[model samples]
Target: MPMAANEIEALIREGIPDAEVEITDLAGDGDHYAARVTAESFRGMPRVKQHQAVYAALGERMGGVLHALQLTTAAPAKE
Candidate 1:
């Protein structure tokens, strides 16, 4: 089964409480998605590590039920 956008966002939020998450259905198919996650907590982390954090939130579903995802992460911009 494909994961829902809200479910992805919820999972990211669960892992990073301060995350600003935006999910897009890339292929108009539930199996493909692109997620943009911004959080202050991501500051100072390498891109790979930042992505790892989001993947960790999804547990074992990354290549299973979640299928494909193009993920982007960033620290929130300072005001």
Candidate 2:
């Protein structure tokens, strides 16, 4: 079974409490998704670690139900 966009978004928010998450069904197939996650905590975090965090949130689903994910993460603008 493939994961839902809301499910993915919720998982990301759960992992990063204050994150602003946007989940998109890139292929309309539930299997392929694109996620944009922005949070203050990610301010100085490395990109790889940020991606890892999102993956960790999805947990075992990464390679299983959740097949492909194109992820983008960033901190809120300094302003």
Candidate 3:
């Protein structure tokens, strides 16, 4: 079973709390998704770690249910 965009976003929010997440179905397939996550907590973290946090949020679903995720993550812009 493929993951829904809202499900993915909810999971990320559950894990990251303050994260702002946007999910898009790239190929109009439930299996392929692109996520843009921005959070203040991501500040000072390395990009790899940022991605790791999102992957962790998805847990086992990443490899099993969700096939492909094109993820982009960042800390909020300085204001």
Identify the candidate with maximal lDDT: 3
RMSD of each: 0.7, 0.7, 0.6
Q: In what order do the candidates fall by lDDT, top score first? A: 3, 1, 2
Q: Which stretches of candidate 2 lie over 4 Å from their true place?
A: none
Worst 10 residues of 1 by lDDT: 1-10
lDDT of 1 by residue, 1-79 (tens): 7889999999999998999999999998899999999999999999999999999998898999989999999998898
Clashes of 2: 0
- Would you give me the overall lDDT of model 3? 0.95
lDDT of each: 0.94, 0.92, 0.95
Candidate 1 clash pair list: none
- Cα-lDDT of candidate 1: 0.94
Off by over 4 Å in 3: none
lDDT of 3 by residue, 1-79 (tens): 7788999999999999999999999988799999999999999999999999999999999978999999999999998
- Supply the TM-score for candidate 2: 0.96
| TM-score attained by model 1 | 0.96
- lDDT score at residue 26, model 1, on the 0-100 scale: 96
**Which pairs of residues collide in candidate 3?**
none
Clashes of 3: 0
Give the alpha carbon lDDT tens digit for every residue of 1-79 in model 2. 8899999999889999999998889999999998999999898899999999889998999989999999999999988
